[model samples]
Target: MELVIGIDIGGTKTKIGLVDKEGKCLEDTFFRTKEYPDIDDYLDKVVATIEELKDKFNYANILGCGIGAPNASSKNGTIENASNLLWKGTVPIIKKLNERMPMPMRIMNDASVAALGEMLFGNAKGMSDFIVITLGTGFGSGIVANGKLIDGFDGFAGELGHIDMTLGDGRITGLGVKGGLEAYVSATGLKRTIMYMQSKYLDESRFRSIAYNDLHGEDITKAAEEGDPIALKAFDYTAKILGLALANFTAFTQPEAFFLLGGLVNSGKWILDPLHTYFEEHLLEVYKGKVKLLSSGMEGKTAAISGAASLIWESHTDEY
Candidate 1:
């Protein structure tokens, strides 16, 4: 039984898993990433977890490890200046992991790993060209063109979140970019929309009683489900931006489909329906009705684990 360790590093939490070639996470656990301010302590815990998984499973062959993190670079084997992380500088991820566990390992940003996972195991399995957008704490994207992951000159490609789409007055992102796509369309973005709508529109709803800090994306989705006008309007607003941007993206690579993943995707049709409408309506005549928008085959922790583990198998393909 050949297995690989998959680690998904997030801003607040980290998901660790033992995965096989079939895209299954046999054993998994969650760890607090923010709690450890030091990278050495964090690596020690991760290495310990891997050792426990190996011993418990008793697999004949334990293959390499794959890590998906914010601002991670496969070329440099380090995570560089990630805004959401506690670490302030470039952390040598592969070097630290290799010191404890001697095995073949790979590292890439979360979105890139997710895109690779989609190509290997998710809905975009057979597609040669596609994009995966992650709408979590922030908006992120991974692009696969001609069946190869495009890592740009230094592994920082497909950063759709930072693209300028506004008049530079929109909400400031973690990286201090105003009007960035992530600040308007992510789960955090949805919350901002709800609060803004509450101020402008005097809609009498449950959200009125909830404080701005207390409100969440899920709360907005629940409100929309119950026919709350404010919540519905928020989705429309968020979707239009995402749709227009996605439509514009078609001209770049003309992907066969765009797969949506992460927390905001859980809103289901509330987000998808309007996104499709706006995307199709705004698409250029040449690209109209040719591309598709698909949901992720695996969402949440499973998607992260499977995506990270997919890197272990990524070498088998000629496409990188």
Candidate 2:
């Protein structure tokens, strides 16, 4: 069985895995992403880690490397201006990795790789058209049209998160975009909504007991599950914004479904129910009742690692 090295670089940690073709991670490990201030040093550590894993598993005949990172470009094999990472400017990740490894390496933004993983080994199997929306600390999306991932001109397409949902004068995103979809729908967005609701409702809001810095999405979710009015309202408002944005996305690509992935989906019915309701309400008549909203078939570290591995398989089959 052929194996691939999969790397998922996040704001805080980097997960490396040895993944097989079946979307199974045979071995995995991690390191703090923030700890490496220099790109070369980071790559060196990654290579060393992979080598250690290889020796431990006695793995041989490695296919290649597949990486998912923020602001990564599949076309250029580079991560450009990734605000989350400690590195500045464009980092030629593929080039850097290839220098140390014998096999080829490919790179793409995290969301796109997740979509590929779904297409190859998850719920999206046999589906030619779909969208994967990741609702975590931030919002991310991957669009698959005609059975191909749309990388766009700069390989930065499928940025559904940055869509201007508010029209104008809305919550500012970390990207400095005002009223961006991520500003209202992501985990960070949920916390912001909770904070806003606390201010508006004052003593009437249950969130009044929580400190601004201590409040988290999990807290809001817990409260919503328990029937807290403010928490429920926050989820409703977030779903409304996300659903409308999804509705707009449907009009453009008309995907068969939208798979919601990541931590926010754990809120379960609290988010999905309102999201489905608002999505249908906002969708165009021609698109209404056609597109399906569903949760991701894959999750956790394995899902991301599998997605990264799938990129290697995809490259071999010309399916990427």
Best by TM-score: 2
* Residue 24's lDDT in candidate 2: 83
Best by lDDT: 1
Clash pairs, candidate 1, are none
Query: Each candidate's root-mean-square deviation in Å?
Result: 1.8, 1.6
Question: Model 2, residue 236: displacement in angstroms?
Answer: 0.6
Q: Provide the TM-score for each candidate, comma-separated.
A: 0.95, 0.96
What's the lDDT for candidate 1? Answer: 0.89
Q: Report, for every candidate in turn, its global Cα lDDT versus the true structure.
A: 0.89, 0.88
Worst 10 residues of 1 by lDDT: 311-320
